[model samples]
Target: MNKLSKLALSIGSVPAWAFTTGIVLAAESVKVNPPKYSVVSVGALLSGLVSAAIIIAAILAFVYLVWGGLNWLTSGGDKTKTEEAQKRITSAIIGLAIVAASWALIQLIANVFGLNFQEGITIPEIQTNK
Candidate 1:
């Protein structure tokens, strides 16, 4: 082989050798672990998720109402801008109402089903010999 060909082959092999060494080091350092969480049952997980959603919805509605009020104040007496701001405020109110209704519905369903939120939902576990 010519000198140029040998030089090119050496340069190409350097990257391959570096990548193989890096992969070996990475593989040796990697460790497997199960994720830790307080919520064990599916019901508990869902309850937490629902509660978070309700809080976020309420916060977003309040922010929307504030934004609409600001827009109205800065509208400079333009009729169209005022109308749009009014619509935005109205939509924010509707969103709040929907969130409240959903909460009530969830409470009603939970009551009827006797699902207690205080005590996390219990699910039966099946045992098998390892």
Candidate 2:
């Protein structure tokens, strides 16, 4: 019912209270620090990636499933090959779905763990470079 929880719900994520840790750990990483992409940015990026992956995988799985089904129907009762195609299509679809869901699940878990889960509202430190 607070601002943070409202913001989280608006952003389609779990309530901030669920995650007790503040996720603003600002230690420099070994690799390049890519322009202060904070928790909100990372969450948005992750959501986008997961959604895209789900759409793509769903499309691919559907195409293969349809192809396999039609091949089976048109094969004139070819039991052996038809079964093989069916099995392959089924496996592919299941695998793709699992992969897509896995990413989404990971994102949700990370949110619950309070990793990369802050609202983007931090003022930047003033630079004094001469």
Candidate 3:
């Protein structure tokens, strides 16, 4: 196989190898006394993941904007390069707007359902019979 094909194959296998390793390690480190899983905990985990993804996307959009600005500054009167930089900036701005809108939508939906996104999930105490 060619060098490029070999490189592609290696890259494709990396995630599989990492996943297998993680599974093996996790199995070996199994806890004797695991914490009880609850719907509230799952909801909290999902909420945290969604929040993190939105924050990461926003950060990436800002980085893209900065990169586009740098490109524009270094274009030096080249029309094509300037246009490309402008497009990049426009795309970044649109992405940021979409992220903001998604966040707002999530908040609106949560409010409509009477769920407090900031308060996190609340687990109810279970009383045991004596």
Candidate 4:
């Protein structure tokens, strides 16, 4: 087939494809359930993200500590390797400390300001005349 004929043939099938797709979609009666929790505002999203970050940081810190311990155990009396492993352990401890301190600080600020981080912030909506 020539280019023009091929293009014409392809274009002619578009309506048939659309009709088939519409029929198939109309044949199904799908029900969607409402979500248990809905994110109503950006503040809620940020709060959720922070909570997830805290959990991830804690898990990562634990993994790093265990990895450092294994490295140290397998160092086999090498001073350089031992030193590296010690640094890793120190870093992991520092990371864990930072995460804890930040969480404490957030809690303290929340208490001082009477802001509820757990429930997240809700901005008042401004309604306009339709």
Each prediction's whole-model lDDT (CA): 0.86, 0.69, 0.86, 0.89
Best prediction by lDDT: 4
Summing lDDT over every window of 10 consecutive residues in candidate 4, give the lowest-scoring window.
19-28
lDDT of 1 at 16: 88
Local accuracy of candidate 4 as per-residue lDDT tens digits, 10-48? 999999888773334355677877577877688788788
User: How are the candidates ranked when ordered by TM-score, highest leading?
Assistant: 4, 1, 3, 2
Residue 63 in candidate 3, Cα distance off native in Å: 0.4
The TM-score of predicted model 1 comes to 0.65
- Higher-lDDT candidate of 2 and 4: 4
lDDT of 3 by residue, 27-119 (tens): 456557545643347667777778889999999999999999999999999999999999999999999999999999999988888877665
* TM-score, candidate number 3: 0.63
User: Which sections of candidate 1 miss by over 4 Å?
Assistant: 1-37, 124-130
Stretches of model 4 off by over 4 angstroms after superposition? 1-33
Q: Please, what are the lDDT tens digits per residue for candidate 2 over residues 28-90?
A: 767856566444454566555656777787778788788877777787878897887789778
**Pairs clashing within candidate 4:** none
After best superposition, candidate 1 residue 35: deviation in angstroms?
9.7
TM-score of 4: 0.71
